[model samples]
Target: MALLLTANVAGRTNGRNVARLLQNQFPAGPRAFRVPGVDSLNHARGQPVSWLVTRTASISGQELFNNYGLKPNSELILGYGFSLPHNPDDTIVLKVGGIEGRWEIGRDAQGADGLWKVILSKFVEASDATYEDILDASGMLQEMLESLIEKLPEEDIAGNIEVRADVVEMFHHYLEGMSNLVAEKPPEARSQVKMPFFALW
Candidate 1:
């Protein structure tokens, strides 16, 4: 909050003793928090902190000012500790040959769901490998996704649930994306990418 209000209090001194007034309002704390200045880490929560906050309150939490409004469910849950039941910013990324292709799955904005034949054509166009090779590697990937999904139970497997249900939902979305990729991509040379995150085979 203080971070957002600093600019409002900067030049709008209004002829009053703004510095002293702000100091009285906020005094000091454990110096646990930081306020950005010309230098990133030079300022602390001492003077004008609450003044900054109060001034920005009028604009704070307003959608126009919150850049996080478009973040996907996965990022919000893991980074910000919050998520909507249905976020339209969600995406599924397909990492192939060290290249990543993001497949949007948002309600208002997603891909046209590529045709299997078109996808396979693209694969053939991009690489020199045979159709059989692509299928074998893709089969490996699909099985990997299926196995991970299967390992996670609908209900908690034991007294302790290690993964959140929402996280599982994101994975399901990823699996859906993979299913699309596998369905369309043509056979190719053996994949050189290691499967640590996606496999042991």
Candidate 2:
């Protein structure tokens, strides 16, 4: 199954600036490339950025900005298209800023399009610590697991009472561990907490 991951980043950067940043930061490969900057990359690397973009020569950076209402210091939506094996156990990991999260690859509620979509939100940057520290924090991990279980269908919960209870207990321990870790950190080294949204289509 092919998945289209879209990350909408909004800060003090414009679309063109963001496009340039992606062109440099992202790997030089077939599956990843910037929009307007893609033209040059395709010319130099002999790789096609997108079929639609190739077919339509009129598509340009300015056109994308105008179409999406992207302006100076506005939110820029970047997309990455990739393929994955069609399996229920498969999961997709999303990393933004300094935060990372994951979601199982599955069909949506309607399931009409026959495509798998996994959406992960609440991504934020960590200043004083690594992404693993924030993502693996006891409270954060518990919240992530609870959110995943809550999304499960009620019919799927019939035989998982014990397993769910176990997870709850694990969450409690994680919270305790995280609290200790935080207490050990100096007050000046602590970072403010902020959550950003990330979505996949």
Which structure among the candidates has the greatest lDDT? Answer: 1
Task: Report backbone clashes per prediction.
Answer: 3, 0
TM-score for model 2? Answer: 0.17
Candidate 2 lDDT, 1-201, residue by residue in tens: 111122345753244554454456544732323244422221111222332223223323523211222111101111211111221122222232344443212222122111111111233333344545543442443454345445433323355356555444434433333232222221211232234411100
Tens-digit lDDT track of model 1 for 56-110: 3334344212234466555765765555444445554443344346444343224
Show where candidate 1 strays beyond 4 Å.
Answer: 1-67, 96-109, 112-118, 122-157, 160-201
Model 1: ten consecutive residues of lowest lDDT = 38-47
Runs of candidate 2 with Cα error greater than 4 angstroms are 1-89, 92-136, 156-201
> Candidate 2, which ten residues in sequence have the lowest lDDT sum?
69-78
